[model samples]
Target: MQFDEVVYRIRIAAGGGLLKKKTKSEERVILKGISGMVLPGEMLAMLGPSGSGKTTLLTALGGRLGGHLAGSITYNGKPFSNAMKRNTGFVTQDDVLYPHLTVTETLVYTALLRLPRTLSKGEKAEHAEAVIAQLGLSRCRNSIIGGPFLRGVSGGERKRVSIGQEMLINPSLLFLDEPTSGLDSTTAQKIVSTLWELANGGRTVVMTIHQPSSRLFYMFHKVLLLSEGNPLYFGKGAAVLDYFSSVGFAPSVAMNPADFLLDLANGVATAESNEDQAAIKQSLVNAYKTQLSAAVKSELDVDSSLHTPTNDRKLKRWSNTWLDQFSVLFRRGIKERKHESFSTIKIVQVLVVAILTGLLWWQSPVDHLQDQVGLFFFYSGFWGFYPLFQAIFTFPQERMMLSKERASGMYRLSSYFMALTLGDLPMELVLPTVFYAITYWMAGLKHTAGAFFSGLFVLLYSVLCSQGLGLAIGAAVMDQKSATTLGSVIMLTFLLASGYYVQHVPAFIAWIKYISISQYTFKLLLSSQYESDQIYRCGTNQTCFVRDFPSIKTVGIGGRGSIVAVLAMAVMLVLYRLIAYVALMRVGVTRN
Candidate 1:
């Protein structure tokens, strides 16, 4: 693999976040004229501090970086093509695994999604088992990859699990971003040893490492040291000390070579002030460009004998068909979400709310028309906010994992989306059904089977709309706190316009009632229970007009005149999801 003349930059706003003026974005250079190569069966380690361009260079080599990047990267004699993509794997610094899934389960699902279609499901499972043994992870195969709140695998084991995921496809070329970060020295050594072994197996491996120990540092066949986006040294790991020694910057005392090199890259021990430090840095950079540039440049220079790079390599087909993708994703979604959606705290919250509402409105007579309308309106408001808040975090929580998988071409975005919207039917409906069962009979609004089922259907329909709206908002914002605040505002507006709060309103805002879902649901629930000509006894007289009721008039319901309301909500049900799909296209499931 080789990358030549790699350059990258970005444009950032000069003004503050809250500034109102249209400030011009300032251009900032990130990686500056980076160029290097690693042959097959060689393990290359990139050494740098926090702000250096190690990751940017790695991403560019992987064909995953975008944003004013100018470079030519090729594997063998071929350019970055579909065939190269299929044969390459990238492991990010953060572990994006589901905390609830066991290590065995994690790899098996990955294999099922990524392995060639020629393999059967049983074959995929066997492949996962082989990877477990190969990575020395068999002892912890059944352990859950835990998170901040859950404990299952150790830090080193978690990192291995991430590597195993990429290994499941047997990729020939691999790029890893700081895989040994945050691990103890012992664990870090073991992790690097694993990479060394993999490279020795006739595969090319490139990784960015931070602060490796002496033992870990020697495991790399080659090393590239970077500082402030500039290359300082690129050569054999064993010869770096000698090269710096010849240039009058070698370590003054015995020290880990990695530590000594880092000190040199940062202009350490050679400066007395910040200006001196900058002068020292400039001297080393000048030395490398003059002494080392020719050799590396010739290695990367064009050769007419090499095959011309092209993207014409036929891409491999996905492992599963579209239908099969949906089936597998749907099952996996259920397993991953069951514990979160059906936690004891959430179950108790719904049950307690239902019991309280039911007991408050227990067995009222038919003459109590106003109280009955209030009860239905309460139901509308509760379900509107309940389902909306529950769904507002689904996409945001999975944003990282979704991006990683999509970039890897694991599954079709449409298939994963269908699994998301359809697979939640059973889980999302469980508590609502329970809430209805507990509250419907306890409150004496309707007793007949026809009235009962119709009201249930309307509530479920409303729930779907509310949940779709949540999904749209979540995808659009992609921030938990911001989405939550927006959800609260939207649900509040719908509640205020539900017709039970105010009968008469100004002409301009009166149109809010037409768009409010709560108004329609409240009106439908009223029409299902009471007829237009129904009479009641009020104020010592046995004659009261139901049509003249203020709440009923605002919702505009009279004698089955709510067909438009039902249709509007149906449109909203599909419309919100379409909006969500478009927003997610912009946010969640993107590939570059």
Candidate 2:
């Protein structure tokens, strides 16, 4: 609730070259004994020139310092705790959003995760709509939050949506870093004005702004001007002029206050006298000390020692545990099925591949069991790489949105993990069904009812295993380029380890087969199709066909390799989900 005498100190190694070792020293103090408060119904603006540590100070106050914090930060006279940090909402400079999701869907999805579970879906939707209207985003509520590839909301609107997302949780304190950094002048002013209005409505708003326009400067009730990590001014907006005047240097009437302060801070202008300079500096120091002390007192009065009333009385009735959270996420996944891109290119790819496979092994009778086994392996391996490649290209966009929502405490990492697992089902089912139908029939594999079901089961298993592997790889690498490179490498490795070219793998590399989803899927499919006693007779000499197929039969549970395939897929799903969870937690939802 308040920060008293907060200081953020940093030390770095000095310059070093190949011939000399680096020297360690306290190179600089990024935030030198800085102090500020964000009381209810107040808006505090942190202004400073570049490299003045404005963002660093804001992060210190917001409890997002990670390993960079120094000194004490107290809330209501008690040291800041994790619970206190959770009560605040922070919006970073980047507009992290899902390009495919419309503004309304984005907000509603966030609400489902962050809002108390007791609220009905109708209540949640109503709450989200109200926030949308409040932020003046109603005109584009249904529009997509676009990137270079997709088109929808403008930069200003997207910034407002990010703010709306934070408000959905009704946080008592809101922190924003350069909220309008990249927007045009008109849009920037409008955004700051909206923030001013929100502060007036009983929310504590603290934001770090760089080079705000003249009009925007007047919206701040209080300002913290920093220079080289030291506080130069911290007090009322109008008082800044008087403080400057007291030092015998008057600012031009037309000069912007922020620009004037920054010029003085950078030592570009000289004070009339040495005493004038000292007097002005002393005045700022005293003002900061007094204001910081006052903030501490205020925070002490409403300390957590005294029982505070609950703000969300309505939230008491909604009680969704982890299971309910999973279910809600699962439903959202189903709804997102339409977002899957099944373009003409994808359909054409399937058709082209089908024709090629069919023509290569044209109407091969069941007697050619070796050929059938080869066809099964080829189809399974090809389908295996499909999901992996698709995920590498598409998952990054979803992850961008996921990170934003996760930062706002919309849902637990596990809930999102479950949703993604469930959401991919429809596409997985459709692609494999199409690929297998065309390939299996075209290759002229035995089409007995049992054989048809076995082929379909194998295809589904390949799809699931591929998706799981893709999800794992996506989670592990956050960047698109890195993920794509890693995905290609893993797919290639799997292809090699799947026994396509090398029938006998080295002893040390033998374990790779267990780890490779393609290996299991192809192996099971090959065994099921090539078994000597199966209805689909390969050659008149069944012995030769059976001997040619790998001896690693699907021996686990029942004679059905399909069952083993299912078991392997189940294991892959859990492994991938676990990898996703750990990666999400370590890297977090924030892109930077």
Candidate 3:
């Protein structure tokens, strides 16, 4: 892999007012003319103090950085291509693993989705086991990869698991960002040793290191030292001391060469005066540039457009077919999310809400038409809010995992999404059906089996629609707190426009009732419970026609047939999910 004159910059809004239509923007340079190369069977480590552009250059070399970038980057004397993307593996700074899954389970799913289709189930399992043992994760294979609140694997163990995920595919080029960020010295040395072993296997390994012990530093075959985006040194790790010593910046006392290099590199980055920082950084950059022999400079320069037709022919889309992808993703989604969907707390919450609702409208009289109508609307409101909040959290929580797996070309977004919405159906529908079984009868809405089943269908349909809307919001926003806030505003608007709170909404704003899932749901539930021919008692013991009731006349504007209500809700259900799919497509994968 090689990168020449790689430069990257990002534009950000400098300042803005609450009502202003525009804001001042400025560009910040991240990487400036960074160039380097790593060959197969070599281990290269990027070393620098914080804010030294180490991570930025690492990302740029891996073909993952996205910004205003210039110059060229090539792998194996060829421009970056789809085939190289599939053959590469990238581990992010943070280990984004499912906390609920055990180490074994995590690797197993990755193998199943990513390994070649020619591999059978047993072969995939064997591959997963191999990665576990290679990474020394056998002892914790069955332990959960826990998170902030959950206790599971240790820090070193978790980092190994993250590396194991990339290793499972047997990638020819592997890139890791600070794999030992929080590990102890012993653990950090072990992680570096593992990378050394991988490099010796003929795979090109490159990584960014925050700081490393001397032992860990010696494990690298080559090192790239940077300070404020300026290269300070680029050569063998063993030779770094001599290079810096010859430049008159060697450590005064005997100390670790890695520490001495950081002290020298960080001097410019943390200098008090801006002029001094720039002067020192520029001199070091020029010194490093001048140090390169003319012969080596000529050898390093190459055409960025060089084509490797031999590797280009190996560009394959995915490892498995659509059906296989769906099955694997479906099972994985279910296994990972079942705890959140059907935990004891969630079940108890649903049961408690159902019981309270049943008590609120217990055995309402049939002639009490106003009370029965209130019950139907309340039921509609409950299902709408409950399912919306539940499904709204799906995509936000999985954004990191999705980005990671998709970048690796493990599975198509469509397969993963189809499996996601479909797999959760059975689990999502169960609690709502239970809520209705109790609340429907206790509220005295209807007596016949046909009435009960038809009402159940409408309830489930409303749930699906609300859930899809939630998914759309989550996917588009990609932030939990923001999505929840937006969802509340939208759900409240739908509830208020359901034709229950105000029988006659203003004509201009009343159009909301058409798109509101709650509106049609309330109307459908009203029809399910009562008929037009029914009669209710009036003030003086005289009877009034149910057709003349206020809610009936106002909410029944779309005609009395359940077909229109059902069909409208169905259209909304499909439309909302289509919106979600498009939003997800925009989030796709990161590439060159």
Which one is best on TM-score? 1
Clashing pairs in 2: 113-410, 118-318, 367-538, 367-539, 369-538, 403-589
Give the C-alpha lDDT of model 2.
0.71
Off by over 4 Å in 1: 17-23, 270-275, 301-313, 558-560
lDDT of each: 0.85, 0.71, 0.85
In candidate 3, clashing pairs total 0
How do the predictions measure up, each by TM-score? 0.96, 0.82, 0.94
Model 3 weakest 10-residue run by lDDT: 268-277
Question: Of the pair 1 and 2, which is ahead by TM-score?
Answer: 1
Task: Go through the candidates in order and give the C-alpha RMSD of each one to the true structure.
Answer: 2.2, 5.1, 2.8
Residues 1-592, candidate 1: write the lDDT tens digits.
8877788998896674654766787998888777788877899999988888999889888888877998777887677766777788899999889999999999999998888788999999999999999999999999999899988899999999999999998988989999999999999988889999999998889999989999988888999988898888888899999988887786767889999888877878433334476777788788889987777888776564643344543455465788878888898899889989999999999999999999998987777878888888888999999999989998999889989988888888888888999998889988888898788889876678988888888888889889999999998999999999999998888889787887777788988877788888888877777778876766675677776677776775644457987898999989988988889898636773
- Best candidate, lDDT-wise? 1
- Tell how far residue 10 is off in model 1, in angstroms: 0.4
Backbone collision count in every prediction? Answer: 0, 6, 0
